[model samples]
Target: MSQHVFLRGMVAIRLFSALAELTGALLMWRFQRLETAVRINGLLGLVGPLVLTTTMALGLAGLAQSRLPAARLVWIGAGVGLILWGTRR
Candidate 1:
C-alpha cells in the first residue's frame, strides 16, 4: 500500500531468494536418493525463480505509476537481473 511496505517486501523477497538457493544447494549436495531427488531439485529449480519473478514484478508494479529514482532503479534492476542470471544456470 505504501512505498515503505513495498521496500520491505523487496528486501524480504531478496532474502528469501538467497535462502532458497542455499537450501537447494545444500539438499542437492547432501541427498542423492532417487525418489526425493527429482522433487527436491525440481522444487529448487522452479519455485525460487517463480517467487523471485513474482516479487520483482510486484516491486516494479508498485513503483510503476510513481516517479522512480533513476539511479537507484537502475542499480536495483541490475542487481536483481544479475542474481537471476547467476542462478539461471
Candidate 2:
C-alpha cells in the first residue's frame, strides 16, 4: 500500500531469490563435504557483492521507471505476487 512496503518486498524477494539460487547451485554442484542442511543454511549467512549489485539494479529499474514497459498495476501485482510467494508462511 506504501512505497516502503514495495521497498521491503523488493529487498525480501531479491535477497531470498539470490540466496536460494546460490545455495541450490552450491548444493547441486560443489560443497560435497557439507551436509544438505548445512548447504541450505549457507544461504542464511549473506550474499556477496555480485548479488548485491544485481539486487540494486533490479530495484532501481523496477522502481525508478516513470512508466514501466508493463502497466503500473501489472508491476504492482507482480510485486505483490513476489512478496506473497516468498512469504507463504
Candidate 3:
C-alpha cells in the first residue's frame, strides 16, 4: 500500500510536469512567426528563460532535498541568478 501511494504521487508529479511543459510549448508556438519589434515575441522570450530556470531550480531543489538542506538555498540562488541573467540578455 505504501509503495502504491508513492507511485501514485510520482505519477501525479510527472503528469503535472508534462502539462506544464505542454502549456509552455503552446505559448511559445502562439508567439512563433510573429515579426520582430513586437510585444508577443518579447514576452514569449521571457517565458522560455523563466521556464528553463524554474525547471533547473526544481531539479536542484529535489536533489538538494535528498542530499543537504543547506545546499538547497545555493541551488535556488543559482537558479534565480540564471533567470535574471537570461532575462537581461
Predicted structure with the largest lDDT when compared to the true one: 1
Among all windows of ten consecutive residues in candidate 2, which has the lowest summed lDDT?
44-53
- Judge candidate 3 at residue 79 and give its lDDT: 70
For residues 1-89, what per-residue lDDT tens digits would candidate 1 score against the true structure?
67777778888888897898788777866886766777877877787777777788778767753778777777877888899999776
Candidate order (TM-score): 1, 3, 2
Q: Candidate 1 clashing pairs?
A: none
Tens-place lDDT per residue, model 2, 60-84, is 5556554555676467657756765
Question: Count of backbone clashes for each model?
Answer: 0, 0, 0
Model 1 residue 59 lDDT? Answer: 86
Candidate 2 Cα outliers beyond 4 Å, as residue runs: 31-89
Lowest-scoring 10 consecutive residues by lDDT in candidate 1? Answer: 61-70
Q: Could you give candidate 3's per-residue lDDT for residues 1-89 as a string of tens digits?
A: 33444445555665665676676667667767546325544655656555555555565555555565776678677777876887684
RMSD of 1: 4.8
Superior candidate under lDDT, 1 versus 3: 1
| Residue 44 displacement in candidate 1 (angstroms) | 1.4
Q: What is the Å distance of residue 13 in model 2 from its true position?
A: 1.2
Show the lowest summed lDDT stretch of 10 residues, model 3: 1-10
